[model samples]
Target: MDQEDPGFSAVGEVAGDRVTVRVSGEVDMATADAMFRAATPGRVRAATLDLRAVTFFDSAAIHTLVRLADHYPGALKVFPSDRVRRVLDISGLGHQPWVSADQG
Candidate 1:
C-alpha cells in the first residue's frame, strides 16, 4: 500500500464478485495495516488474499487475518507462503475457518 517502505508491497484486483490480493514482503506491526487494507478493499461476496510472495509474517499480521476471517466468514480466504504458514501453524491459526491451502 505505502510505497514509502520497500519492505512491504500489496496489490489487489477485482475478479467478478471476488477480490484477489497479492501481498509480498514483511507483515509486521509496521506493515499489517497496509496489508489488511490491501487484502480487504470493501464488502464483497468473496475474497482471496494470496500471500505466496510474503517473506515475513508476525503477530500483528496473524491478528489481522483472524479479524478478516471473523468478519468475512466463507467469503474470506487466504493462501500463505511456507514461512507464513509456519507462523500460522505455530500460532494455531492455520486451520481456522478462512485459511486454507485450497479454497475449493
Candidate 2:
C-alpha cells in the first residue's frame, strides 16, 4: 500500500518588493524550506508572514525566519501569531522586524 502524507499549502502574494505569505498548515523541518523558497528575493523592504491560519510550527520554521532576517537586514518583517512570537522571542529576533498579527 502506498500512503503519502500531504503537506502544507502556503499562499504567497508579492507586490513590488513586499511579499505576504500565508501559511495555513504545520511548519516543520520538512516544510520550512518551501516557505523560505517562496519568499520574495533581493532585499525586500517588508515581508509579512501571516501565521494566523497556522496551527503548528517548529524550530526549523523559526530557523527559516532567522535566516530571512539575517538574509535581509532591516528588510524582513514577520507578522507572527502569539505562539510563533514565542519562538522568535526565544531566538532573540522578535524585536527587530517582527510585528504582532493584529497590528497589521
TM-score of 2: 0.76
Over 4 Å off in model 2, which ranges?
Answer: 1-7, 41-45, 101-103
Clashing residue pairs, backbone N/CA/C < 3 A, model 1: none
- Looking at candidate 1, what is the lDDT of residue 33? 84
In terms of TM-score, which candidate is strongest? Answer: 1
Query: Residue by residue across 22-100, what tens digits does model 1's lDDT show?
Result: 8888988888888777767765667788998889998988888887777677788888899998999999888876777
Q: List lDDT for all candidates, in order.
A: 0.81, 0.71
TM-score of each: 0.85, 0.76
TM-score between candidate 1 and the true structure: 0.85
Candidate 2 per-residue C-alpha lDDT over 1-104 given as tens digits, one digit per residue, 9 for 90 to 100:
32211657667788987888887777877778877877755556667778766666789888888787776677766777777777667777677645564546
RMSD (CA, Å), candidate 2 to true, equals: 3.7
Query: In model 2, what are the clashing residue pairs, if there are any?
Result: none
